[model samples]
Target: MQPTESKGLSSSIFISRCRAVWIHIGEMSCSSYKVKRISGFDPPPARVFAWRVLELKEQGVREDDAMAVADMEYRTQKKAKKKAYKELKEIARSEGKKPPPNPYPSAIKEIQAEEKKYVMDRLFNPKVIEIANKMKEERDKLRQDRAADGL
Candidate 1:
């Protein structure tokens, strides 16, 4: 690894050196060695958690409360779907028509619904995702500005 000029990536990056200038900052490079020299957390997990907790607290709800609300909504939707399906069955019986497929495939769909709830809670319960999205947009804007300025 030839020296760009003075500083190069840290030891962590030099452990596995690839010979291609993937980037150019100053003498910019993709060498992980200089990763510490880079600013900002690549991705912050604890920050996300803290943001989520703060967001929920501001909204006057705990995580369990949010999960309960989700479950209740799920149940309400299930009940409504069941009612509609039953009503369709009544109409079919009176009209001597074949009943449509069970609109409420709860038995089969329950797992999927549960899985969706799990994912939503795990990934989106807190406002961390929203915060992350906004941060990404801001960072992208900053990069664009820097690029425009020939930085």
Candidate 2:
């Protein structure tokens, strides 16, 4: 573009106009380009399902109701259902006078054991350590090769 001396519009005004025109043309061109649709299909039905969480909020439903709805719709396993139910019941109990049901002993024990295993694996994972060592060795070899090449 040619540099303007004293033109019809000031330099900054001219630049802004150019930017606006460019953006308008770009947007028009992009709008003309066809975007692919994901699929001509509907979503699968879940046994339990909640409406979109945002829609619930917009409709001014209580937080507990929204979460419960979401969990019921989305959670597939019995364990997940139990967890969601327990949480909802607990919240309700806290708000009211009734005490929440005691969780089943077997389920509680299973949950505890699973949790313990998760913690142990996170803290001391032999496979992870082996992988880390191998990665460090590979990186060191690459560094050595680079140094030899004066890179």
Q: What TM-score against the true fold does each predicted structure earn?
A: 0.33, 0.25
Which window of 10 residues has the lowest lDDT sum in candidate 2? 18-27
- Backbone clashes (count) for model 2: 2
Q: Cα lDDT of all candidates, in order?
A: 0.54, 0.50
Candidate 1: lDDT of 21?
14
Scored by lDDT, the top model is: 1
Instruction: Evaluate model 1: give its TM-score.
Output: 0.33
lDDT tens digits, residue span 47-80, model 1: 3333333344346676566445544554686689
Residue 32 accuracy (lDDT) in model 2: 26
Please provide the root mean square deviation of candidate 1 (C-alpha atoms, Å).
Answer: 26.6
**Candidate 1 residue runs with Cα over 4 Å from true position:** 1-58, 106-151
Q: Find the 10 residues in a row with the least total lDDT in model 1.
A: 12-21
Cα lDDT tens digits, model 2, 76-97, are 5557767877887888878996
Steric clash pairs (candidate 1)? 9-33, 9-34, 10-33, 10-34, 13-33, 24-28, 25-28
